[model samples]
Target: MPFLRENSGKFSPEKIGALIMVLFPLALLLIRALNGSFTPPTPFGAPPGLGAGPGLGAGPGLGGVDPALGARPLVEVIRFIGDWAIRLLLITLAVTPARRLFNWPKLLIARRTLGLGAALLVGIHFTFYLIDIGSLGMAAREIVLRIYLTIGFVALVIFAAMASTSWDGAVRRLGGERWKHLHALVYPATALGILHFFMQQKLDVTEPTLMAGLFVWLMGWRVMQRYGRGTGLANMLALAVAAGVLTALIEAGWYAVATGVDPTRVLAANLAFDYKISPAWWVAGSGAAVALASEIVLRLRPLPVRRAARA
Candidate 1:
């Protein structure tokens, strides 16, 4: 209902659009699931990247199946839902930056919807994980012992708290300032989710690297905003480059340590696009696109001029 209603209790185009955006991913998941597209999952998660093509189990490194899932329909289902949860979380965090860039305050209407969607998906993701295990006791013990599971469970708890208190009554009880502080936990929760995602990867980490880069850009943009430089084109360009380089370094470091590959070769892979486009370039290209949009917005919708105070 909130997704369909504005704060004034009237249906607005913004809310309608937001509702569609919120449900589209779920709809895709349902369509795919019903079609038997979801198959067994990899040891880490699903496939290596989007380029690996559609469907749940349509990627390389499909050899290492999650023992818990063991060819269950829920194996790929868990990964699919979990990935979308992180996705919505990132999109929710992007709301503020996007609003400022395009001067579209209406975007705020969808922020909570996106966050709630993320919360729901993550809950489902965990529930599927439990169902796949087929034993509450074993699942509970795994959460306690496995570092990745522990981090993911903690992040889920934080998401639950945020979602529970997202209503008007909670806002009234907690007051605006305290509520703001409580919701700020989204950042750390996202970080932990990202860490859990990274640690779970078995072979290819294309999406994880991109996720990390975007997270880096998001944090850097916030820091720049604190210093009153967030909206500048030069600042954005710098942040973009920094984020991309960091992405490359993250991927290189992971390959070097995890697979015993040379870090320099990994870095060089970013330059050679013969096989793939690499996450670093994707991160940088995304930021550049944002910067270009901001420029167009600034020029086309320049702020109104103010006259001097009357004497």
Candidate 2:
């Protein structure tokens, strides 16, 4: 009670928003856990019906395939969670840069909560994936050996390590410089998560493309900050390099798909693309763009301050 009273002022609008952001994912997890047990509405924009399709529904007599064989409810839930987790991680990473550009101190409080929540979601995703793989009689070594799976595993490990040392006590123990260096691993973790998604999808790269765009924007802000204004030549060169790499990867992935090569077979096999656009993707893109824009506007506009009279 004393601690609560002492910290009552911390429950400001910004803090409340941060709390809501963290709770939203937790609510989704809870809904997923209770989905089949209580027949809840599809938790993660799962297209109206729960079981309806060739490889996603609960239809019986489909070549002796179990009704639940298509899209495991748990897997769908976990994927939805993973998607948000990555987005949240990106958002958390952007906060410091945003603060630097906008000169806002309030943004700092939200970062820790978002980072922790993202880590929790990633952990949930890993747990669900392992359980699903085990149920299919696949060995851990086999799962770990897959390119995308390995990437995802490494990303999750990095995220877990970062999350474990997120608190003030851990920061003090590790020292600020060491802590900062360790947390920078988040960038690579995010890239790996995006790669995992790109490899996991069977059809269309729309989602991955949008995610890449967001990451580009986030990283661009940092570059702009570091280089200062009017570094157009450097910016162009960086953009060209990024675009070239992305084009090559996209081409390679498409080639692999066309030839049935399955460069990331292990990771690809586990995914059942039911062929539907996820609303969450749009929502996330819109929200992030809006937030970034708002920060930009705030920076451009100055708040009025009262002046003391000389008389």
Candidate 3:
């Protein structure tokens, strides 16, 4: 934290945010380790079935005798981290909108750090995936064979390029225009990442569906901003509501295609309070909350008063 507080540039709101971004994935890894996901006893890759050794039960560590070892799969941690990478990348994209929405100009400083943090997490996720598959060769083979992996790998490559050019020197060298063009790759990278998420999941695509919904909203907001129409609180709130509705429709469609479930049932489930809160509600709530906060803040800031002096 001391290092985090040290002067790098002008103090910006994103400074603290950048530090948190670094710590978040590390904390997740720590949690996974504490839950016994990292007690493999050996440095080698986990073979086909984890905890499948001759004497070991189907859990973490050798012989599965460690009390720390639970039934949770270590490979799931890879998915968790990968999901976080995608989320962080989305957050990075959201920074500009957030700054505009909240009138927090200093937030601009945090965007690059967030992008790089996402790239770093993605790199770690990919490393664990390679380890899980046993070797680089096998990983490469799988990527070639699997469309989802190919999509994810392409996104990673784009992130890598963006990360490499994130410095002042790169801006100076490439000129701002070219650099902006290159960084625009984040758009397609995000699409591919979301697609990869949808494809890789065998079941329970609620999370990916929410992510896609958020992505759609973010892009939609950008378009609105471009056309100079959606910068106000009311418009923003409307966008949020629309996005939530779109999220529900997307989820319903996916279930219809993948599971042969009645899309009407899925849509009706959004109206029902019989189940846990769905992602659509979460997305809508988040958007509305942000919009309300911005409205409140704008109202609270007092206008300068002019005094008339009496002779």
Compute each candidate's TM-score over C-alphas. Answer: 0.86, 0.66, 0.81
Question: Where does candidate 1 clash, by residue pair?
Answer: none
Model 3 steric clash pairs:
none
lDDT for each of the candidates?
Answer: 0.77, 0.59, 0.73
lDDT for each residue of candidate 2 in 164-224, tens digit (9 for 90 to 100): 9987898899999999999989888898888776665434444554566567656655665
Q: For model 3, how does the per-residue alpha-carbon lDDT over 88-192 read when each residue is reduced to its tens digit?
A: 989998998877666666677777778888899899988877766776776787778767778889998998999999888999999999999999999999999
Report the C-alpha lDDT of model 1 over 46-141, residue by residue, as the tens digit: 343422222223222222354454444565677778877887889889988887777776788778778888898899888888777777887787
Task: Say which candidate scores most in lDDT.
Answer: 1
Q: How far is candidate 1 from the true structure (C-alpha RMSD, Å)?
A: 5.3
Candidate 2's TM-score: 0.66
Residue ranges of candidate 1 with Cα displaced over 4 Å = 1-3, 40-71, 304-311
Q: How well does model 3 score by local distance difference test?
A: 0.73
